[model samples]
Target: MAGKELHVTDIFLAVQVEAIVAREGAIMAVEKGFSNYVIESDSLQIITALRTTTTDRSVIGLIVEDTKSLMARVTGEVTTHIRRTANIVADCLAQFGRNIGANLTWFEEPPNFIIHLLFEDCN
Candidate 1:
């Protein structure tokens, strides 16, 4: 899933938005029948929140809880925080999505635009 689209009435902090997106990504992975997966985010705060077992009563409490529930259902789920420089492909795709103002998902293979970045990331 890509692009920024939140059908909410109130303004959310950046960390909250990142948490929401992480939750959505987890949901998609589970729906696609992925039993093992690694979720990486540039937001260390969100990653830390997900790693914790305690209940979060903050503004993003519900989103974090739901994400944890999804993670529990997976067989081997890993969540980590990486610097944005280490995730150039995701960053580029996110920028592309924002430019187009639409949400997009690509399975099996990514779009042509980020192919080189993906290769570079792997190497």
Candidate 2:
């Protein structure tokens, strides 16, 4: 959902659960001076748009464009992942954003609550 309220370009990859990670997330993470991030629901839709080369552009086109722009400035390969279960961490972030009234910002990194609640048990 790339809009004035929440920009998809703000999201970045903090961790990779599987062999693949999202290109958009990877691009955002490595971007310079982008500290805070806000991820929205319907993440799969954004990823799908980026992966596909079809000209059937929708609202997701903004997301794909922002991702490509960010990727050019960032370093490293973008990873792609399968399975909803594998995306629990990002899923939780989306939930948090919804649970809150408006956008939530993190300074230089994701909040401690997220790290403790989600990434502490990384295996």
Candidate 3:
């Protein structure tokens, strides 16, 4: 069975940190020993950049670089782009983070309020 796991991080940034969340997911996969897995994101551009050798020079590029490097540390890793509608848990978690004003949060199990969403997604 897949052990329950959730990670959320927030930081005060002067600039936009759009792609960094994807990077954080990569970082989590490596740190948590996800040997064979597919990482999904709503952003196609971020997923494409991760699958290419092109250099990213943007402010969040360093984070993306770190993500790429971390992805390399594991085996059988795949990245895919998904629609936001299919990623409701992640979307809710992000909103939860913002609402709670938490700089960082990790949920070893599903959050209580999201139980219904999880059930709905099953169908």
Best by lDDT: 1
Models, CA RMSD each: 4.4, 9.1, 4.8
Kindly list the per-residue Cα lDDT of model 1 for residues 3-121, writing each as its tens digit. 23334335458787688788887887788888786888999888999999999888898999999999888898899899988977767665555566556666765567666656664
State the lDDT at 104 in candidate 3. 51
- Identify the runs in model 3 with alpha carbons over 4 angstroms from their true place: 1-18, 103-108, 116-123
lDDT (tens digit, per residue) of candidate 2 on 1-123: 111112233333522211022434434465434443333323455545545666425544554655555554544434243567776766666555545556444434656667774755533
Sorting all predicted structures by TM-score, with the top scorer first, yields 1, 3, 2
- Which residue pairs show collisions in model 3? none
Q: Candidate 2: misplaced stretches above 4 Å? A: 1-45, 52-56, 107-110, 119-123
Give residue 2's lDDT in candidate 3 (0 to 100): 26
**Model 2 score (lDDT):** 0.45
Estimated TM-score for each candidate: 0.80, 0.49, 0.71
Per-model lDDT? 0.75, 0.45, 0.65
